[model samples]
Target: MLYIQLTPFPELHTERFVLRRLQQADAPALLDQRSDPRIMRYLDREPDTTLEQTTALIERITQNAADNSGVTWGIVRPAATQELLGTIGLWRIMAEHHRAEVGYGLHPDYWQQGVMSEALAAVLDFGFQTLKLHSVEANVNPHNTASRRLLEKHGFVQEAYFRQNYFFRGQFLDSIIYSLLTPEAAKPELINEAATEL
Candidate 1:
């Protein structure tokens, strides 16, 4: 596939939010986002239990971005104040395969507001347009209906289902794999435009 770097790191923007690289100052918000059981329910990792754990997570994400292995962005709405709403990222970036895994979480306060849906569209744009990725993948717990719906709305198709495939937090969980090819990723822009016309 031979994917080349488009930008070392890109700050993506949508009509209502900014998706930028995470920083140490965002640790408090990250802690809040990661610790929520509602947000962490389907994730493979445990709910972050401490500020130190959040700080460590920030460091790891920063390092991965630098290494070109992955990148995470803080979802910020910069209006009267720079408020962080959630986080989204492309991880396990496989340049040789031109693919990566997409992960995201939003504060419960902002859920059902179309915030994650908007932010993810921008991230997928960056992944396909900027990074030139051929496809993007997502692993969702089959029970997370809302999350699965969001992925489906973004044009990801169910590619596979693995029963009790992921061992996490002293239990195994079923996983449904979804994927969006670059061609499918392109529809979001047009979809947005069509929405605007109505």
Candidate 2:
């Protein structure tokens, strides 16, 4: 269940976004996103983090790219301002099983703008069709209505809802797990739209 190695790092694009390798230089842009309380609460970093920490984070992302454990794609807006707005990646690749966990985050400024969904659509296609993956799963905080809706919009079902899964912001929070298989994906055009490579 280690399809990660076979899943060659591929560059993905859409009308407004580009999915490509994450560089250490991206730390500053990412810090802009990570600095927000909303984005950092569920994440491992705090809002008042240092540049070195961002560097370390980018290094970890680079390690993922080098180790081939998973592929991290920096979500960028390739228009007048080529800014790194967010990140979308596939991790915990179980190639033998042809499944992996997908995760994403975007700057609050870009939230509710369909940016994450578009980026995900591009990646899901690369995962299922190009890499031949069979399924993708996601874990979200139940309170994250926007993210939950995004998953549902992409055809991921609410497979599990666990209470008090992780403690954050000085309190425990519940988690909702979502999953979408190839068969499930095939039924929804949105899920399968980018699935067919160009």
Candidate 3:
């Protein structure tokens, strides 16, 4: 296996967005996202009610990268504006296993525009090519049809079904796990999908 460095942040670019490290200035945008019901629909945690919480979250993400355990990026489009539209990241990174769990959150206003599809394509490329990961997984609420469709578009296969095994906001939620192998991470169709308007 070829070894790859997982530490030290790197910036990624897509046709319409830039994926980069979370910064203090991003707290407000993150706070807005977390507080929005539409954006937090399937998320496990409560809405971030304060900028301090968002700041702390950013700090933890930075520390996780430093420890080589995880990486998170804020998605921004330069020509459109500096405001963040969403976040994408790898969590529970098990280097020994050559795999990681991926997660993302986007403001509802930007949904169905292909923005996330674009951002995730770039992230998968970094994971498979740069980080040398064998596979990437995503866990989603079964009811999150949009997220499921996005994963499917990128060649991710449903790998597991956990019925009511997760509790969020006082309800037991069914979760589905989806995975994409490194060999299939960057397919031509996915690249084409990323170019669509977002």
* Alpha carbon lDDT at 63, candidate 3: 89
Q: Which residue segments of model 3 deviate by more than 4 Å? A: 1-7, 184-198
lDDT of prediction 1? 0.87
Model 2 agreement with the true structure over 37-104: per-residue lDDT tens digits: 78876664357478787788778877776676678788886773357888999866677788889988
lDDT accuracy of residue 64 in candidate 1: 88
Taking all chains together, the TM-score of candidate 2 against the true structure is 0.83
Q: In candidate 1, residue 124 scores what lDDT?
A: 88
Q: Which residue pairs in model 1 clash with each other? A: none
- Model 1 Cα displacement at 144 (Å)? 0.5
User: What TM-score against the true fold does each predicted structure earn?
Assistant: 0.88, 0.83, 0.87
Q: Candidate 1, residues 149-178: lDDT per residue as tens digits?
A: 999999999999999988887988899999
Where does candidate 2 have its weakest 10-residue lDDT segment? 1-10
- Model 1 spans > 4 angstroms off: 6-8, 184-198
